[model samples]
Target: MPNIKSAIKRVKKNETLNAQNTKAKSAMRTAVKKADTAALNNDENAKELIKTAIQQVEKAASKGLIHKNAASRKKSQLMKKA
Candidate 1:
């Protein structure tokens, strides 16, 4: 219920950005889960999975969907698990 036109436009833009961020976050989580599972299973491709997960975390951080330190921490943990 924004009264000003600019306020309404801002709200719309925020909604779009929120959706994009949510999607990116969801993808990051899924990638992390896959990497963890692969590591747990001792799969031969676990290294690749961990690498992909690290890349996803980095991309999410770059896109401002997650904090840089958080992404780096995640990557470090994933590598340790692998």
Candidate 2:
């Protein structure tokens, strides 16, 4: 409901960005969960999951979707449990 034309455009752009970020975050969480479960169960796929999860986390951090410290913390925890 932006009155200004630029504001309306910005709102549209923001909505698209929000959707993309939400998808990325959701995928990251799912990857992390898979890594955690695999680690706990000693599954053979755990290594792959951990690798992919770490990559996803780093990507998110690099994109500014998540904080660097949080990314490092997640990677550390993921590594620790694996």
The TM-score between candidate 1 and the true structure equals 0.92
Q: How far does residue 76 in candidate 1 sit from its true spot (Å)?
A: 0.6
Instruction: State the weakest 10-residue window (summed lDDT) of model 1.
Output: 63-72
TM-score between candidate 2 and the true structure: 0.97
Model 2, 1-82: lDDT tens digits are 9899999999999999999999999999999999999999999999999999999999999999999999999999999988
Q: CA shift at 21, candidate 1, in angstroms?
A: 0.1
- lDDT per residue (tens digit) for residues 1-82 in model 1: 8999999999999999999899989999999999999999999999998998999999999988889999989999998997
Candidate 2 lDDT (Cα, 0 to 1): 0.98
Q: Which stretches of candidate 1 lie over 4 Å from their true place?
A: none
Extract clashing residue pairs from model 2: none
